[model samples]
Target: MDFDHIAEKKQEQKATVWLNLWSNRSPELLSMQLAKKHRPGETVSACLWKSGAFNICYRVRYKDGPDVILRFAALGRAILRREKVQNEVPEVFGSGICWAGPYIVMSFLEGMPLSQLLKDPSREGRPVLNPQISNRSLKRAYREMAMLILELSKHEFNSIGALEENKRGIFIARRPLTFNMNELMVSANLPEKQRDSVSSEEDCRKKFTARCLFLNITKELCAEHSQGPFRLYCDDFRPSNVLIDLSTSRVSGVIDWEFTYAAPAEFTYVAPWWLLLQSPEDWESDLNQFLIRYFPRLRTFLEVLCNYENKLIEQQLLSESQRLSPRMEHSMETGLFWVCLAARYSSMFDEIYWTFIDSQYYGTFTSLDDRIQLLDQEQQHEMNELVKLKTDQSTEGKESFTDHYPIDKLLEL
Candidate 1:
C-alpha cells in the first residue's frame, strides 16, 4: 500500500480499538469490576471518560465520594506493572482482566490535565511562550513542579532499573522498562531484543548498535557525580500525565507511572522537556527557532527550581550537596538536555544527534555519511545493517501497518 493508504489504515485501526473499548463499558460490567473497592450495587453510572494512545479510561460515578477511573489497556496486554516509587500517584483499588477488558481501578483525582491549562492553540505555528497562561500562574505551577522534582530526587536507589515486587512483596530492582522501549515493542511490532533476551545475536546487534554508542558517548560526557544512586525517573512525567488545579495553580496528583524507573541522576538533573508543551525533536520549526522560544520558559523554570532548592535546604529536607538546579541549568547550557532526550527516544535520535548533539562534540559534518566515517569498522557495519533492516521493514508486507491493522468492527474483537 501507499503512504496515504497506510495512514488511513492506522487511523481505522485506532478507531476500531476505541469502539471496542467504548462498547465494552456497561454499567453492570463497571460495577462488577469495581465491586472489590466499593460496596456493590450502589447504582453507578458509567461514561466514556478519556482515551490515551495506549489505554481508555471510564468515569464511573456513585452518589458518594470521588468518581472511580476504570482503565483498560487497549492492546490486550497488562500496562500497569508493579513499581514502588513514592509520589503523588493515586491509590490503586484493584487491577485484573474482567469481561469488559484488562482493567485497573483507581480512585479518581479531581483536577484537569496540566496539558489543558498549558495549551495555547495560537502558539501552534509560532516559536513563543504560551500566551494563555498568566505570568503569576505559570510561576506558581513551576514552583510546585520544582518541589515535586526535589521531593522525588530525595528517594534514591542503588540500581539503575525499575522496582518490582518479589514473592515476599518487597520491591526489588529489575530491568528498566522505559517508555521508548515500550513504544518500540508495541507500536513498531518489534520483538523483545534486550541484552539477555533469547533473540538471535544479529537481532540484538541491530537493536543495540546505536544504543551502545549513545551509552558510551553519554558516559564520556556526563558528569561523574551524576552517574550513580539512580533516582526515580518517569518518562511520561510530562504535563498531560500530571493533574493540576487550575484555580490554585498547584499539582494535585501525578498519574501514569507505567514508565517510571530508577535511572541515572542525570535524567532528573536535566530540565523537563514539557515546559514548552512540545518535544524539541518533534518541534515544527528548526532547532534554532524552537530554542529561541524554549529558552525563555526554561529560564523561568530554572529560576523557580533554584528558589525551591534553597527552601528545601533551609527546611533540612535537602542537603546542599544534593542541590540539582545548577546541574539542570548546566544541562541546558551545554546541550546535555538534547543528549539525554536522544538517549531515551530512539525514533528521534538521528534528527536530534545530527541537529543538536553531534556538532557540539565532534564538530559539524555535512552529512550522516561523514559522521559514520568517524565510527570504527564493526560499529559502521552494524549501523549499515540496522539502517537497511529498518528501511526494509518500512516497506515490508505483513509487518507494514496497512496490511496488519484491525479494520474489523468493535464486536469482532
Candidate 2:
C-alpha cells in the first residue's frame, strides 16, 4: 500500500466539516453544536492519532473542567449514515463498545496508549520505556484490558433500525465467516516456494466450493435457529481503542463503536482478538496480566461470561446446520466455503490476510518453516480435499503466491 498516497486520500476523504470545523469555530461557537452545556471561554485543544484508519479523533480541553474526545467518521459513509439513522452510535457509546464508528464526542480519557510502553526496538516511532517498570507492571496492564473486555461483554443492545435488520442486526445473529488463512498466505507476500505451494489450481476450486456451501448453511441456520432479543455494539474491540491511566493501570473507558452490530454475544467476545496484525503472544501475555490484577475478585465471572457467549455460538451453529441446504451445511462444516468467499471479497481478504502474514507487525507464531509445515498438514489438506471435490478430474491448476510489494516497499508507506 502507498502510505503517502493512502494518507493523502484519507485526508481528502475526511469530512471537510470535521477537518475545519474546530479550526474555524472557536470553542464558544463549537459549543453551540454540542448538546452538552459548557462554560464560557473553554479552549479546545486537538491532537490526532495519525495511525488510525477509520475515524479521526481529537482531544479537546477546557481551561476549567475536563477534556473530551471527538471522533468523526473517516470512511464508508453509507455505513456511517446507517449507524446514525439507527441510533446505534449512542447505544454503542453508552454500552462502551470499542472501535466502531461514524463520529463520537466523548469525555477525554487520561493516560497513554500501551504502545508507548511496548515500543518495538527496530522502530523509531515511539520512545522506549524504562526496564525498571517491572514484569508486574506489564501484567497489570494486561489484566486491566481483560477486565475491560469482560465488562463490555455484559452490555447488550437490540436491533431497532439497523440497515439490514435481518441480515446485519444482532437480533438475527450469525457467526461471521472465519478469516481465510490462504488469502493471508498470499497477501503476506511470501517467497515463491511458499506461495506456489499454496495457490495451486486445486486450492482455488476447493475454496470456491466450500464458500458456496458455508453461505448456504449459514442462511439455513439463521432461518431456523436465530432467536429474538439480542444486543450488539460496534464490534471492533482493540487495545488502541481503549484509554488507560498509567498510575492506576485501569481502563479509563472504551472508545470507538462505528461498526458496532447487534448480534449473538459471541461476536463481541471474539471480535477483540482478530487483528491478525497484532501478535497474539503480546495480547495473551498482556491481557492475562491485566485480567489477573484488575479483576482479581472476578475470576469466576470470566467463565460464566465465556459460557454465555459459547451458548449463543452453539445455538447459532446448530440452527444453521439444521436449516442448511445439504450443500451449504457441507461447506460450512468443512471450512472451504468461507475461505473462497474471502478471496472474492478481495479488499477485506487483503486487510485481514496482511494482518496474519505481516510478521513484522504481528510476529510469527513460529519460524516460517514451522508455520508452513503446520499449514501443509492443516490448512493445505482441507483446501486440497475441497478442490478435488470441486474441480475437473484430469487437470489441476497451480499458481504461485507472491507479495505485490516487498517489506521495504511497505515500510516506505
Candidate 3:
C-alpha cells in the first residue's frame, strides 16, 4: 500500500485542524483566557491540551459538571477501523471503564503520567517505593490495569481458531519481525549514485540468514514446553500507559490497547519486564522490588497465575486442534505468522526489528560469517564487553530478594 500517501493525507488533516483552531486569535493565550472564564462553582474550564502525538485532546468542564476529556482521532479510515476493532474487544468496556468509541470521551483522569512523576525527585511527586503499595490509592491503579488485561484474556475470538488447534500458528506469529536494513542503507532523498557503496544482494542475504538462525534458536527454546495458548498485548504496557493519581502514586486507569491479541500465555507473563526494556541491569535494579510490591508472596501467586494461564492455553489449543493445516502449523511454529508476514513485507525496519530478530534467530546463520567479520574492531570489542558484563553479573552473588518468576516464564512460548 501507499504508506506515503496515507501519511501525507494525515498531515493534510492535521494542518487543516491547526488552521481552523488558530484562524481568529493567538492560540497561545487562548487556554489561559478560557480558564479565567471558569466560575467559582465550575468543575473545570474547557481548553485544548496538545500533548498527545496522534490525537487532539480537549479538556471540558462546567459548573457542577464533571471534567471530561474529548479526544479527536487524527488518522484516516484505517486507524478508525483499528480503533473500532479495539472497542469491540470486550475487555476494554467489560472492566467497567467507559470509553466513547475510538475517539475517546471520558471523565478526565486526575493524575500525572508516570513519566512526569519520575522527573520529580521529591517523594510526593514520585511513585511510592515500598514493600507493598497498600496506599488504597496505588492499589486501584495497579489493580485496574491488571484487571483490564485479565478481562481481555477472558474474552476470546475464533478468528484464529481455538488455542490448541492453532498453537503453532499463534506461536510463530507472536515472534517479532524485523525490518530490512538494506532499505535504510539508502536515504529516500539521496541520489542513486550517492548510495553506490551499499552492500550487494548476497551480503544482505547473509545478514538475513544470520538473523533467521537467531530466531530458530529462540523458537526452539520457546516451544520446548508445548503448554497452551493465552492472550497478549504485544505493544507497550509500561507505566507511561498508566495514570497514577498525584496524591497517591497509584494507577488510576490503563490506556492503550491497540496491539492486543490472543497468543501464548508466556507472551503475557513476560510483558511487564519486556515493556520495561529488560536488561540485566534492569532485572537487578527492580525485579525484587516489583515482585515484593506487585506479587507479594510471589511463589504461590506466580504458580497459581501461571497454572491458570497455561490451562487457558491448553483449552484453546484443544478446541482448535482438529482443523490445523500444514501452513497453519508452520505459522504456529513461528507464532503470529500472518502478522509477522505483514511486518516483514512492510520494509519499515523500526516496526519489524523485534519480529525480524525473532525470525532471524530461528532461520539460519551460516551466511553471516562475512558480515560478522565485517564488523569494525570497536563494534566487536563492544559485543565482547557486553558478553563479559552479562557473564560477570550472572555469576555474582544473588540478591536477598529475587523474582520468583522463572526465566522461561518470560518467553513467548
Local distance difference test values of all predictions, in order: 0.64, 0.39, 0.38
Best candidate, lDDT: 1
Question: What is the per-residue lDDT of model 1 for residues 103-159, given as tens digits with 9 covering 90 to 100?
Answer: 677777888877676677576542334666787778876787777788778877777
Candidates in order, TM-scores: namely 0.78, 0.45, 0.43
* Global local distance difference test of model 1: 0.64
Across residues 346-382, which tens digit of lDDT does each residue of candidate 3 receive? 3332223333343343344244454456455765566
Give the Cα-based TM-score of candidate 1 against the true structure: 0.78
In model 1, the runs with Cα more than 4 Å from the true position are 1-18, 21-28, 31-43, 76-89, 121-129, 165-170, 192-215, 223-227, 246-249, 279-282, 366-370, 383-413
Backbone clashes under 3 angstroms, per model: 0, 32, 47
Model 2 scores worst on lDDT over the 10 consecutive residues at 176-185
lDDT of 1 at 112: 87
Report the lDDT of model 3 for residue 381.
60
> Each candidate's root-mean-square deviation in Å?
6.1, 13.3, 16.2
